[model samples]
Target: MKTRAAVMLAPGEDWKVAEIDLAPPRFGEVLVEFTHAGLCFSDEHLRHGGLGDLPAVGGHEGAGIIREIGEGVTGLAVGDHVAASFIPTCGRCDWCVSGHSNLCASAANSPGSADPDTFRFSLDGNTIPANCGLGTFARHSVVSAKTVIKVDPEIPLDVVAVVSCGVLTGWGAAVHAAEVRVGDTVVVVGAGGVGINAAQGARFAGAAHIVMVDVNPAKLEFAKRFGSTAEFDSPAKAAEYLWSVNPVAGGADVVIVCTGNTTQAVVTSAYEMLGTRGRLVLAGMSQDVFEPNVHLPGTQIVFREQTIRGTIYGSCNPRHEVPIILDLYRQGRINLDELVSATYRLDDINDGFADLRAGKNLRGVVAHG
Candidate 1:
């Protein structure tokens, strides 16, 4: 089958909409007709050469329906609604069984072709890898069963799409990784798509103070609707506010970093906002993979008993958390509708990303036709 998709042909290039050939799903895979795909910064990272093999179809966060099931597939059927998980989970893996599906062993080889010699998507007879092994940028994608989670059909696909990645990652970073407790003081840096949810998560966890820090004034202001009790333009100002309110600790109980691009400087600033026995959660992706971006004083950490931890997919199992998140959405506990600041047609994906770069949106979605 031939499907229209947004393809990133090279690094530092705009996404190009092209007609590509898609093969039928093989055993243990399924054909998904994607309805919506979120414009996550991770894909922006891919556009700038941060993730996955090149010449790939872009997009990792999406929601769709199973149009066809391949051989040996069970527990899902045609017409079932689902969301894509960028990190594939093999339930038998040690991490998955231990409630850490985000760290599933299969993730090491993710977003790559199932068969190295053959590809699921191709153009002009040249093979193309799907970003995160489930290129929801395309109208239809053949993805491994492991990269998708079943969702209730009543939920809107666009809402489910954002939760699939940004919402899940941010919420879990605060609730699971940071272990936000009642009356805790929390700080979330970078008030973008993911960071906003971190603020909401902190509020849901009963944090007394949920402060948002971002360079963009608009983003900082926008975060208030999502449960940010206060906003600041820089970590220093936020730190100052924390000190004034909680002078004894001189910082927050938990600080979550959700910047579009993580940096050594950002990590250091986030760490400075942590008080005694505080936890610093790094949920952002650094541009340089090999760079040692974290530089913190070991003695201070030892004396203060502070912790610095990194999380992928917020350290929450997709299959387990996706449903709970959707349930929260259903009950009006989480704000999914307001999270989508804009929506675009697939052909306008490049423009959508441009808006992302300009900080014009909290989260953007591509409505696949």
Candidate 2:
């Protein structure tokens, strides 16, 4: 059947909205009719060639209902609400068994390629790749069963969609990767979608002081509603205030970076804001092959016992965290509704991303009509 999709033919090109022929779900696959897709920065990274290759569908964060299930599928059925998992965990992989499905081995394949080079969509007989093998940019997709996580029907699909990426990554960065402790002072840089969730995670972990630093005053205010205790216009001010407030520690116990691009300045600033035995978490994306322009002085790091960490998907197990996160939203702990800055039709996807690039939105959801 024909499905409307946004395809990225090459780097630096606008997404082409066109009709593509979608095949039926094969073994261990499911057909999904996407209702909402989030304007995630990772998609922007794909557009900027952060992820090599092209001619692929453009979204990884989305939620939809199962239209059909292929043979041999279990634990999920048609008409079930679900969210896409960017890292498709085989469940038996070493990483998945160890509760770190984010680092699943199946990701070794190039984006959209699963089952040894088989393509699920074709445009005029030309193979089309699906982003992360679960492209949500299109109205429908035949995705690997490993990438689909069953979600409760009580929660809105649009709200569950953002949890697939930004929410899970950011929240897990603080709650899981950093292991934020009670009474800990946490500093989160870049109060966008991910950073705000990082702040929420800190709050969930019982952090006493949560300082959110961002250049945008609007975002700072928005983040405070979720969990931030204080806000700063710049990292320097945040560092100064930390020293004044917590003179004993003199800095934050954990710092997380959530900007679209992790620059040398941001890295170095995060380093400076750490207290003794503190850690800085890199939870954002940048040029895939670029050097981390800032250098950490080994002498200070060794003595202070400061640590740096790099994370993907916030070091979260998506299959597990997806359900837990949705539960949090259901219980009124995490406010998924407010995180939606705006909503747009599928055809206005480019405009949604434009708002993302301008920092005008926390998260923009595409509602397919």
Candidate 3:
């Protein structure tokens, strides 16, 4: 089948719309007719050569319908509504069996050549790579069966496609990874899709204070609607303001670093903002991993119990959190529409990323076939 897709031809370049040929499922794979694809920052990493990959089809978070199934696939049939999972969790893997499907070994393997199996997608009579193995940027894709997560019919496919990644990543970071608690304080370092979700998760977890820090003022306010107690572009300024309001625990209880591009200045500042026993979670680290400040804050970790963590897809199990979060949205508990500040058709995928990089939107969408 011929599918319309956007390809990142080179680093620091815009994606070009290309009509590519895609093959059907070979085995243990399923073909999804995508209806929507999300614009995530990680793709920006690829565009800048930070991810160190090339000639890759960029699309991780998306929603579509299962159109075909391979011979070995079961429990899912054609016409099933599904949101593409970035990670394909092999049920038998140690991580999956241990209730950590998010880290399934299969998810870390390369696409186009599924180590234990052959891929089903081909472009221009040749193989084309899928991001995280489920490239939803195209009109069609052949992915590992384990990566397809079912969604409710009531939810719009466009919304579900984007949320499964951006929303889940942020929310899961706060709720699952950080395990934020009621009356706690949280500092979200970016107010983009993932960071906004983190802000909301902290709110849902009943965090007493949720301070959002972002370079864009618009993102800060946008994040506020989702439940940010305060918004600031400067962490130091924000912390000072927080101290003014409550000086006793001047530092944040939990600091989520969503801004991937960390400079030397912010690196030290981020760590300095955390209080004793405070946790700092790196939600989106830069493509160019910078040196972290290991200088201790007076042995705070040992004396005060501080912790640092890197969160992947917010440490969420797709099968577990996708439905759970959708229900939260259905009950009017989460603000999804607010996150989608702009959207473009599949052909205009590049434009979507442009808006994301310009900091002009909280989130952008690429509607598929």
Off by over 4 Å in 2: 108-116, 289-294
The TM-score obtained by model 3 is 0.93
- C-alpha root-mean-square deviation, each candidate: 1.4, 1.6, 2.3
**Among all candidates shown, the one with the greatest TM-score:** 1
Order candidates by TM-score, high to low.
1, 2, 3
Kindly give the number of clashing pairs for every candidate: 0, 0, 0
**Residue pairs whose backbone atoms clash in candidate 2:** none
- Top candidate on lDDT is 1
Residues 1-369 of candidate 3 have per-residue lDDT tens digits of 877788777778888788887877887888888888888888887677656345667888899999888989988889899988888767898989998888888774332233423444565565656777777788888888888987887799878987779998899899988889988888888788888899989999999999988878877777768998888888878878766654566688888877756555655677777876788887876655444633445566777688887778889888888998898889999988767788888777777777887998778888765
Query: What global local distance difference test value does model 1 have?
Result: 0.91
Give the lowest summed-lDDT range of ten residues in model 2. 108-117
**What does candidate 2's lDDT look like per residue over 157-274, in tens digits?**
8898989999999999999888899999999999999999999999999999999999999999898898999999988899999998777767999999998877787788888898
